[model samples]
Target chain A: MSQTRDELCWMTISEAAPLIKRRELSPVELTQAHLDRADAVDDRVKAFVTRIDDKAMAAARAAESEIASGHYRGPLHGIPVSLKDFYDTAGVRTTAMSKIFADRVPDEDCTVAASLKGAGTVLLGKVSMSEFGLRGHPTSLFSIPNNPWNLNRSCGQSSSGSAASLAAGVSMGSFGSDSGGSLRNPAHSVGIVGLKPTFGRVSRYGVIPCSHSMDTTGPMARSVADIAALLQATAGHDPHDPYSSKEPVPDYSANLNDGIKGLRIGVPRDYFFNKDGGADPETLDLAEQAIDVLEGLGAQVKEVTIPSVADVRASQGVIMISEAFAYHRQFLRDRHDEYGPVKFRFMLGALYTAEDYLQAQLLRSRICREVAEVFEQVDIIATPSMPRPASVQGDMGHPFSSLGGLNFLVVFNATGHPAISVPCGFTGEGMPVGLQLAARPFQEAALLTAANAYQQSTDWHTKHPVL
Target chain B: MAEHPLPSHDELDARLKGAGIQLSNEELEFFRGAYPEFLDQLKLLYSYDVTGEAYPFDVALFQEPQ
Candidate 1:
């Protein structure tokens, strides 16, 4: 009762965890605050595909009882979180925002979902996403999530609802899968944080496949520290996922505020900032300013280049479409009409020769080597997460878009590096832009530390979207 | 990357048909427009001399030390 419900809704997991541990903030109160906020704003934000109020409240009660019995489960113990509907949730319809899976309910939780549940997170129900995380599908089922900052603008896809919910203050934090920047794009689009951990860092055992080689389950939240907490809960090896890493999971928060006093940051501006490459001038300006902040924090910033990086979107698209078509081969052959606009994009894979796929895989390996050489000289690479700020929903045009354009994002998905998108600043038009930083493989801790330092030095994350 | 000319619209539609997939006129038009860009992406990889005779598995895509 001492703290207003508004404060409860906006408090990051890092801020609320200690309060909950001390019994000053009950899990039940915190969960109810978010539920109320969702009830008040979800219609316009369209973040959740399924809002299980009763189930969420019941879970909150259990968490409260467990903590009261002196059984605290750590930072994410009582957090209210949503999974991008791509994750399979037991007994819940895990529609990947596609009509093809609209009626399909899973009998088991995906590894990430089960792990978060085990960590005592209250499931706030599944959120909307692009059909198979492959851009907008014309005939998709759920309403596209709108940017909470401006109703006319859109929350970028695949991880649309995941970003929207955090931006709208209807959920504390969440997990969203990124393949070619699905999570980071939306994270920056809506003014939040998202981490695409190293490819195998988080298990993808139960996620609906976008591209098996590239699909990575990661965390999305309003702040970098909360992203670290979510990552901590679900990271590490999973026997079910063959790609899962056996690497030791580092304590993500231990060095979060350590500051990047002597870190080396690399800027690959030629590729990401090419105005001809779809980089918006304002977004690039904000990204440059963000890098300057990192330099001010004692990070050495120097321009570096990743060979053949400019054309990665082509490799990413070819590989993604081909694999996606393979996954949907039977569906496309049988229920072709059921696929939304994404089906057209997915089917574009069938157009590529098998040799094209092989070439893409080969290109991925080269990118890995190039990025490693760059990492040898710098601790992290910096760029704008998205090409621009959120555009008006109507201005998004048709669901289909070209993937061969110069893309800064898909490069990491191919190389399998740890990447984070932190709130950089807003545009003159009042939309948020993200400063994306990626580190060497399995170096998510370094990514978080630098991002947390940036978040701390700026008031960007503190400025929430007015619903 | 050999100079593989862009497939004509009829050639593309025939390719889709040959693959047992059918598309609406609008869908075909969209694919018809995007196919060139898609092929161009493939060309970028071949344009580079990176891939050798044996494509080695890159473990860097998995767990790599910082």
Candidate 2:
């Protein structure tokens, strides 16, 4: 069947890959459709920081030539993708949405960028993020991206532009990092899918560091199958990042149809279901209904306790900033005013004594063991991706107002487990909510399997925002 | 577990100075507003006593390889 221009822009990489390989679809056409869509709609979504259209067209033509010559590489060949500005691209500006790096271009591509290129994916351009992934400051050099669902609402921070771009069909897929839900937060807000693989599963080589111990690079897209395809191209060990795991990388697309039959799903209700100023009632109800949907699909569901989850948000806050302080120390000394809203937060790290930081790390170790123990009894842990859906743009801040409450996503970051956020349901106002499912370390195949099954059984993922 | 207290603004100012960083008055006020919340989070983490809990404290594990 012939696809229209809008259809071409919205087509998932999974659907487009085969057509491109068969020459039924031209990569140049696909790339141009996206560029046209961005030209038409990005004024409202404000997603891209830089659009390398000429280079993208060149890459597409090269991809077309290779496939016609019978040198097709893989599923990602000729697929257009956005990279979070945090990634260091060789000749393109890699700003991380900060004034300090606004003019800084790299001499070589980061590991993730190089791999996607080797996979034959077309690089659309660098996208916006919160200044240094802390939060958007009033003085940030770039404008904050707006949510496609509602122009007044936020697309979420750090990976905000990546989410807005995909949701608005400006790019089919994106690569973003999550030190503390940077990718998944936007995925949840914009009604898409994002995966934060196990901490060491993907190399962080050349990506701007946020919190070294907790930062992760993962895939984001409009659908789980697309996310699986992107992850398969990017997830592996790199000698450049010694901390990258040496464990074998699984084919994320292998068992996407392997249903979650009898798979145990645990819901930690007490911590996440806060009443007096916890997660919004609408968010919790939709997540609960999502759990019910999985139960109906033959998955065994139970309410399990991971009590330490309450304490993890706090521990992560302390450790993340403390580590970030070390990285930004020189910058603060030389270019203090150049930092964004993160400046205040980064300086907070200075007040912390070495004792305070290590004590929190010690707590982190204990919490990781406790979470691992819970995993022994259950295969997956399910929770709402955020306490609420997207906030109104211009209201989001560095230390979120919800910081005092429980955060469901931060725990996995602390324990270094794989987590996936999939669009679950919507609020009465039509904003989307996300269901986050996490599995044991390096069990991304299992994670993708469950996420894919859920998306297949529901239309939440297929619902797109009308710009 | 003992409660860890939030430092006074002057004390915090001194710490920032020791780190070779100085903030504008507005920035200092912003820190004042956010510090209590951070200290509250720190309190929760420190509340758990790990008196007998041993965690790796060696710097070599994190130091640049030879």
Candidate 3:
């Protein structure tokens, strides 16, 4: 079968791996097919900031030779993948979409990138992202990756290129980091699966820091099974990352068929579902329908209230801004002229008093305690990923105004929970809507299991945005 | 805890200067508008009563010696 018609672009890593293992297809040919598609669509979509086609093709050839010699790696063997610009790659520019680091190149791969490479995945190149992953419309003067579905619409932020590249078929799977809603927002906007594993599930060593408190690296792919496979390869303890969890990493792909039977799902009524100006009616309807579907799967669904979310969101912003400012202080002082306006101004605002930073930390403690209590009552919580789909393109006058009131996903980041964004449905305009599911701290396995169950029961994750 | 209004553009610029950072007039004006809302959202943290608790916002990784 022809590579394009083989559904390889949309197949789960689990499905694709078996075919390659049996020698039914060669990794070099598969890599070439994806590269061809990327070349045809990337100019219009602007999904990739850098393309290492020669290196990728060389790696693909090596994989084919290795397999022919009866040496097989795991599921990710020979799979072509891309990393967000923030991930450090030796001898490659790891610009975080900011001119501040425009000429900066790291001498080693990030822990996560090293792990992916160890799994025998082909490195495509660096994908685009926001300037320092800062707050602003993605279309700032810095690199703004366009949404593959609608060129003018926002592809979310931070992990902007990961989503666009995946949707545009630039790579099979890609790396995404979430300090706030970077991963989830782009996943929702582009109709892909984005997982923000438990805060400590993946190592953050060598990833450009946005917020040490909330930063997490995870996978974005076309299916939950693929995410599971990617996480299996990436999740582990790295001594270099002080915040890396020492907990035992479970086999995420081993029992993905385990259904969501007898699981307790909580819906935050007042905070998550309140008639806030945040979510549109259509998005809310899809969230409610997702609850019904979970109920039908023998899961108990109930409405719960999380009163401390307002405080949590507030504390998160303060701490993130304060830390981000501290990290970029020297850069802002020496290379101020080179930074894009959005990132430069945003960091400048972080020059508040140390008292402000401490006060935010104190508030953060209280909010974390409150969230821990809420988790005691339920196994997981569900909410709409975004209040609405991606805003119309070129509507970037006031970036935050364009965001409306959609702060649901950011709160989870503040609480340090494991969250995943899966496609729920599409809007009348054919834009994708996402259902955000979160589990308590260090419960990534449970979260992935539930997400896998949902994906198995529905076809949402299998649908890709047609470029 | 009365609502803490954001500092004026001049105040913000002065604070930036105190920290050894400089901003252009256009950049200052751009931040002068956006910082207010950003500060307002961040001020919500002060509304909580967290007296002596350690903030639980730091990342915790399970590490083993390589």
TM-score of 1: 0.96
Following a full C-alpha superposition, what root-mean-square deviation does model 3 have from the true structure? 2.6
Candidate 3: which stretches are off by over 4 Å? A136-142, A397-405, B1-10, B57-66
Over A1-467, each residue of candidate 1 has an lDDT whose tens digit, in order, gives: 68788888989998999998888889999999999989889988899999888999999999999999999999888889999999999998899887889898999999999989999999999998877887754346867888899998878777989999898888898889888889998999989999999988999988999888888999999889898889998999999998788888999989998999989999998888777776789999999999999899989888999977876776677787788888998888788788776777777777777777777777777777788888889999999998888777846554445565545688899888889999999999999999999998888999999999999899999998777
The stretch of ten residues in a row with the least summed lDDT in candidate 2 chain A is: A397-406
Clashing pairs in 2: none
Q: Return the clash pairs for model 1, or none.
A: A138-A341
C-alpha RMSD by candidate, in order: 2.0, 3.0, 2.6
- Could you tell me how far off, in angstroms, the CA of residue A158 lies in candidate 3 after the best superposition? 1.4
How do the residues A1-467 of candidate 2 rate in per-residue lDDT, one tens digit apiece?
37888999988999999999899999999999999999999998989999999999999999999999999999999999999999999999999888888799999999999999999999999998888887654535778899999999988867888899999999999988998888889999999999999887889999999999899999999999999889988887798996787778778898999999999998888887665656799998888888898888889998888867788877787788889999989998899788667677777778788888787788777777777777888899999999999988888655535345656788888888899999999999889989999998788999999988899999998888898
Which residue segments of model 1 deviate by more than 4 Å? A137-139, A275-277, A397-400, B5-11, B24-30, B53-66
User: Roughly what TM-score does model 2 have, to 2 decimal places?
Assistant: 0.96
Query: In model 2, which runs have C-alpha deviations exceeding 4 angstroms?
Result: A397-403, B52-66
Q: Is candidate 2 or candidate 3 better by lDDT?
A: 2
* Clash totals, every prediction: 1, 0, 9
